[model samples]
Target: MIKPTERRVGYGVAMGYGVTDLFGGGAFAIIGTWLLFFYTTYCGLTVLEASSIFAIARVIDAILSPIMGYITDNFGNTWLGRKFGRRRFFLLLSSPLMFLYALLWLTDMNYWYYLGTYLSIELLSAMVLVPWETLAAEMTNRYEERSRLAGVRMIFSQLGGFLAVSVPGLIMQFTGKDNPFTYTLTGLIFSCVFCLAVFTTWRCTWEAKDVQPEHKFKAEVQRSSGLFNHLKYLILDLISSFRIRAFRLHIIIYIASFTAMDVFGAVFTYYVIYCLGKDAAAVSAWSSVGAFAAIPGTYAFMMLLNKLNLTPSSALRLAYSSIFFVLAFLFIVYYTKTPVPDMVFFGLFILNGVARAGLIYIPWNIYSFIPDIDEMVTQQRREGIFAGVMVLTRKSTVAIAILIIGMVLEEAGFVKGNGIQPESALYAIVTLMTLGTAVLLAISFYVTYPFKLTRETHKVLLKEIARRKLGGKAEDCDAPTRLVIKQLTGYEYDEVWGGEATRRVVGQVNCSRVE
Candidate 1:
């Protein structure tokens, strides 16, 4: 068992936390690699029909995400929850069910039946994912520790993604794309991997038994006299959360960029098959080998995090800029319809793999810090609400992306199961994979650029939160506290609002104005 240590975790414990990413990595990688292709080509559905089912399911899931978040946030505090652990119990319950995830790929039932299966899987994800995501916050409070955890998770995420891409490719190399057995065997393999990963995470990781002492007031605020009262409180709390400036910016950046990434995953098969005109083995090799780059890339990211001392937000922006150039070049290569040397093709993907490390890992690391910022402003760490909204944004945009991709595919004149696609259709696929990412990521960057929180800012926020929890007066506050106070209020008061300092210094000359 990984021993519990406060605010700092050993490698064994961090691995337990990150290993669960394998579930998402394997499950989604399979889905991302094959679902759209399976639904259209294998099942003989129209692109619109196939895409619409997933889109509508996501819309339903979007509505359910916040409710799941609320459930996850409070469930662990219950009598049964405290013993087994809220997040841990849900994960344990979901582990075996992960095996059933293969059933999604196994069927091509009537439309309603298919929809039901998809929705069922989506709901199951909400149950496990919302809770699982909150684990890091419970596991450790240190910023660097959280970053380390995200890095470890990325390594495994890339591993799962590699399985999704390469395993199928390897299978197809022998079995050929003409065989339906390829997808079935692929699903079975990936789903089993997914199941074991979630189970391992549940069995190995530790959850915090004692609540953070700073959260007492926030916990009290959670109590309600009736169902209606509780809901009213929930509504009010949700509304209040959106009012935070930093979070609002994160939402914009997160939704746009993440949607683009999701769409890229959805469309990659088409780019490989329709655009590149590669066989199955080649498709899988490029996808899987590219992901291997992410492992080394993750190693590089962690090194940079410690060595460069760049804040996660700053690092994300810088790394993303490099990706923009790479995407631009890839777009040019594909648009020209020129046959590039094999070496160049491999090299481009390798560079993309490096960039993927930052793209995939930085946002999550940044999210761990958001709770700290919320704690500073609200004096409550509401990670569940934030986690809920993060998934909500993602699910909602997924719905939009599927619909748009479906309609766009139809407009591009893509013919299902046709060995050769029209140039127009190929162009659209390449554009969606490259230029679309470039444009959307630029928008994501604009929103992220204004993000005000940094390690320095966060350290200040943590200090203030601890001091407030201890009932320390403003007069006893440190420089960072005084700086924050000056920004919120025009002048720093000598005394805190309810605390016992009589000398209310109205600051004839203030030094703490945030520069």
Candidate 2:
């Protein structure tokens, strides 16, 4: 049974995670929605140049995420009789760095300075984000609870996106200006929000108890094994993660789904402003509705997951299919001159929001369960490897998707400041790409159905861990199973717990002839 204190700590940790996500997502949305326009129209860079810069930055960040993951997993500090751990340390340090770098947006830099500043800020953001994500998996071991945590974090993340998208419009409306100074003022406001997020995350949460002295000691011992050994271990873990058939399938599906989602998000504002000829106020109104809609949709999906006992694959398939069908219908309506009712459009927007909620929340929740399954197989909790590789995959997809979307726009004759193209063509390109990607995502989701580890299977694995002394005390049983219980059911073990029970729990058994 979990204690009240532990629950409180988890809640606090989740809140910190939410805030961090808010800061990151909000900042990115501001950049994605407006920065491109600023570059092409205001700063006078070609569309290709700006797109190339963004793509290269994302690719570099993708490469860096795994490296950061490795560093965090291996090198951590011991504090207050427990390991302060890599995740929290990096989070604390990077918060301020992220804030400082985000202020780069306010500068009036030429092309070279702009490119360099953007790349530098993006790299720093990834350093903060990669490890921050790993912390979420570390914080809990429960499946349903992980979903709840992810749901909460995602809601805040959307709120961040909402602010990022809506704030610029609000600022422009209030100040009665559309100049560079307006953008600078908006960046300053975002910087303040980033600082607030950092402080809350730093002070509000407790480090997980599992991050203790023994884990730190084990990590140290591994360090002495040399660099080649460490590389070998990483490679083996990567291979083993893929060998799990379900995990491999899940990775593929996640790549497809997330790539589509990221591409859509990056381009959605462009579509609204250029293709629909809508202003910031219209975009903000629709975006707010979409963001708020996700809250109820997320809770509904969670309830559906429980009631239906659906696997991640099943949930994803259902959600993706719904998104595709709705988008397709909307496209047809627009193309056929049927004049889709405003109410119908709003409903579709809500559907899109619901689809997005599931797409974002379920995959991470599923991944949180993978470490336990891996531990059951390898007899080691390699949470870092699992989190790292997943980060690598997701980031790589984002990079590739950005590149692809840029190329697609170039091919479709999308020129900066050309004004909206023929309505039919715009509809054809945007809707076909979005809906096509969704269809592929559905296929990938279906392909992953065979790999899912059901709740029953997970229970068996947990029992196996107990039997093999992977998680609990041999003295607690007389079945010769060699089970090692490191702490009481409701207590967390640390250096301060220096009693005989602790010793026995750590497998200090003596074998001598009976006298």
Candidate 3:
């Protein structure tokens, strides 16, 4: 149990972490959302060139995700405690690097320079994010508490999104100019906010100490085998995790859901700018509307989750269904020249915000479920690996989306000097992309239907884990035995499940006693 004082500190840590994470979103608003438009319209890059830069940067970041996860897991500095480990050390070192990275947005350079800067920023940002998200899972183990904490984090995260989308218009209004200078100012301000939040988290947060000393497990293993043997064990452990059917399903759902979401993000700016022929001012207004509405929308979904007693999978299914219908309606309105008034657009934007609430909330909530299932099956707490895999999957999708969006734009006869595309083609592309992604999301959620680990199921799994005491002697259980036990009883067993008395019994006697 956590002490009262520690809980207070944890809340503080959540706030600080929340702010920093949001800052990254804000930076993306200026850079990722607007940068493409800026490059194609303002910087005079061909659509192909701009797309290439985004695609290449994302690919590089995707490759870095798992390696970073491995490093985070193995880090063992003892200045604080075992739980804190090397995570804080890296966070401190990486904070300023994150700030420097945002400066990439301010650079007025050629295509190659833009490519290099974007890649550098993404790499540094990943360094901060992988550890940052891993720490969230480590903060607590309670299901309801995790949901509440996620709620708090999402509230602040949406606030950052709000600021990101809102700030450009504010900048334009204040500066009396719509130019690169406005973007530079926005980037600098966001960097300051990001740094401040990170510093506060570093100072205020405290990690729970691990009962075991650092490197204790490593020392025992090293006494018996060479380094190659340890590497082999690590590989085997990772492979073994996939034997859990639920975990494997969860991973598949996560990859597909996140990939579709990223693809939507990669193409959204083009839809707004080229398809709608809307300027930054119009995009900012719509985005701000969505962001502000998301606060209530997030809370609403939390309530829906509670009231409906829906599993994460069910909630995601409902969300995707709603999003698909909304996108279809938006497409029809845009394509058919339905004379959508400004108020109607505003309403749809608000609905988009509410829809977005699910997109952000459901996936992470589902992700938290994986570690619990892993702990039950593996009898080892490997939250780091779970977090690392999630990071890897998310970035990999982002990379693919960037590449696909680039190719699509190049094929559409997008050019630097051209103000926009023909209305028919533009609307068709935006509508089809959004609707197509919705279909993919729906299919992924359906695939996860069988892997149902509801609150009741999770409790049962936990009770079984505790009853069997599988943590101590999991290695002794052969694969066939593990699979049989898991299938028959939804639990894994080890030597601790049956002591010397049971072991000493003959086969018939043991079988009868087990029955």
TM-score against truth, every candidate: 0.89, 0.80, 0.83
Q: Write the per-residue lDDT of candidate 1 for residues 310-399, one digit (tens) a residue.
A: 766677787678778777876777778778887887887788778877777777777777766555544455677787888788888879
Local distance difference test, candidate 1: 0.72
Clash number by candidate, in order = 0, 5, 0
Q: Which scores greater on TM-score, model 1 or model 3?
A: 1
Clashing pairs in 1: none
In terms of lDDT, the best-performing candidate is: 1
TM-score, structure 3 vs. true: 0.83
- Cα RMSD to native, each candidate? 5.8, 7.7, 6.5
Q: Cα deviation in Å at residue 99, candidate 2?
A: 2.4
Better of 2 and 3 by lDDT: 3
lDDT ranking, best first:
1, 3, 2
Tens-place lDDT per residue, model 2, 398-479, is: 7666666666666767767566665544764566456756665766666666654555555555564555443233344333
If ranked by TM-score, best first, what sequence of candidates would result? 1, 3, 2
| Location of the lowest summed lDDT over 10 successive residues in candidate 2 | 487-496
